[model samples]
Target chain A: MPSELELQISPIVQESLVHNSRTLQNLQSLTASLFGVSAGILGLESYDGFLFYLAFSLLTSALFYLVRVAPSSLTAGPRYFRGPFEFWAGGLMNGLAGFILTWTLFYGLVRA
Target chain B: MTWISKSITTLGGLLLAHACYSAREHSALQSLRAASAASLTSLPSVTTSLPLDIIIETIVATFIILLGLVLGTRPLRPIEWRVWAGKIEREGEEGFIDGAGEVNKDYMGNPFSALESRPNFVDIRKQRREFAEWVKKGG
Candidate 1:
């Protein structure tokens, strides 16, 4: 079922995959911490307003960690999330989450 | 992102801190909705004046944000490794990784083992190569 264009991984690349796997695990843990902080910051005052914010935060965390960290390196990237979905998605999530949390907090203060 | 990440995180963090400090109610009301007859009597006439609590919160938030901006760009006490290893971003949260995967205790806080066994030199060499390649790739 392999396509002709699908490049076979080299042995060194295989070894690198193991280390990268560990690194990805570390990255996932770090990401969870960041998202938890962001979500708490967003939802701290009122429970109702930031459902999307918190939901997106959790969703992004799960997607990135599962796709990028839990899978084998072959699935992650020939280029380490930079090659495909994770790259842009990761950046977008970060931007949106950061924006919403910050925006709500700032405006919320003004209202207060 | 390079320009805005620090500012946003700092400012956002400060604003978040302010929210934590201010009025007990975090209602989404655009205005003080306790604008009913009895509540209207309770509302101060010069309502535009920022409450002292809000003022203090704002001041604290400002200081925190200013400090974060200043320190984010500057080098404090150096870690075991001089280089920053990597970064991860997701859902608007981004973090940096530096000074990781060390071996020496004096240099990097390793446990007393120098009474220590030999390290896997070959693996380290290979990892070093991959890490070098990672840098070359502009990661």
Candidate 2:
């Protein structure tokens, strides 16, 4: 339901996509360091819940960035996302990332 | 009575959440401690043998969050007309725009009249008016 006047997506969407793709790549790389699985095979792994969410985040981010950065439609996604989905997804990403960080650091101290 | 009721509700909620968390932690630590204490033979300890996979996963996740927070820090510069209009084009500065269209720099380092586009304090009101117009137009 975007209006005709809004021409481009916001920079935030591109930023989100970059952030998500990087995080997924980071996670994929971590599998190798922690489990000795090659990075290539990890990329081929089936989409279970965690992997699915991870992949979703990456793909969506990439798609958002791709659509947004094309000069004309950059603001389109942001305009459409003036509703709950944007707010909710942004919240989820921030919240999950924050929780994992706080829990791990404090828990790490406890164990150490 | 209203204040007292609200205070009691808040206190109850806090106590309930605290108790639940304490219970979870206490069970994990207390049982492990009791089990270790009951062991008759003293074995040489190397690593803690806690599940490394879970630990690392948690740590990595936390670090990702922290990295975002760390990187997301933004500067707090206040926006002023002289600061922003300088971006469009200085009064007489020069720079290459897209597709070979050239722009002159303003005193602001904007592509405008690079020499004098930046306002002296003498023209603060004019600068504010221009800035207001820019903001009204969604700049």
Candidate 3:
């Protein structure tokens, strides 16, 4: 979090912050279900399934950074995001429910 | 760019569906073989994981779809006010367009436009002089 004094000096654009985070959230949620489908197809169970989700979620973040955040942000620190945590790990919990939903559904569908 | 991402996502979806079907078939076949073998020799039923090709296809399809989605996302804006305002000044609506090449609906250009176009700043005398000149020259 930026200090109040720091924020006063370099104000934040609320709309841009919302737009950037919303874009990232949408991508994360969509890809979480995709990862779940792949995990199900691979017949991952229990810890294996969770691990797959974790690994793929990080991969999604990395790919997003490489594609979207890295080009313009090469000099400046993550201009679109509030902080590193918001850019990277914030979506982990956001998409976990969707991931498990699709994971269980496809897991049962494939096995049956 | 939008069409490219859409086509890539569609191709990935097709690949994922194929991999799912292959895995289902492989599982069904394994169960059938296990059933027959158990009936003949009283052996424990065997369960085999998805084949390597199916796993690879699923992973590859997922990655491709992820790439398409990330590509499809709207362009992000800088959060700091100066950076954001500078971008607006530099790129105008061009920088704020989405993947479909349409300007975003929420894009309100130039936050200080109201200040720049203040009523007090209007050149009423110049406007009146121009109006009088036009009247004198015409009927």
Among these predicted structures, which one has the highest lDDT?
A: 3
Instruction: Arrange candidates, best lDDT first.
Output: 3, 1, 2
Q: List the residue pairs that clash in candidate 1.
A: A93-B91, A93-B92, A94-B91, A94-B92, B105-B110, B113-B116
TM-score of each: 0.29, 0.24, 0.92
> Model 3, range B47-129, lDDT digits (tens) per residue?
76677889889999998898888888887888999988888878888988887778999999988778879999999999999
CAPRI category for model 1: incorrect
Give chain B TM-scores in order.
0.30, 0.27, 0.83
Interface DockQ per candidate: 0.03, 0.04, 0.82
lDDT of 2 at B86: 40
Tens digits of lDDT, candidate 3, A1-80:
88999999999999998998998998998898888888888888899999999999999899889888999898865488
Instruction: Let me know the DockQ for model 1.
Output: 0.03
Lowest-scoring 10 consecutive residues by lDDT in candidate 2 chain B? Answer: B70-79
Chain A TM-score values for every predicted structure, listed in order = 0.34, 0.27, 0.95
Rank by TM-score, descending? Answer: 3, 1, 2
Contacts from the true interface found in each model, as a fraction, amount to 0.00, 0.00, 0.87
Worst 10 residues of 3 chain A by lDDT: A74-83
Candidate 3 clashing pairs, residues 3+ apart or interchain: none
Rank order by DockQ, top first? 3, 2, 1
Best by DockQ: 3
Better of 2 and 3 by TM-score: 3
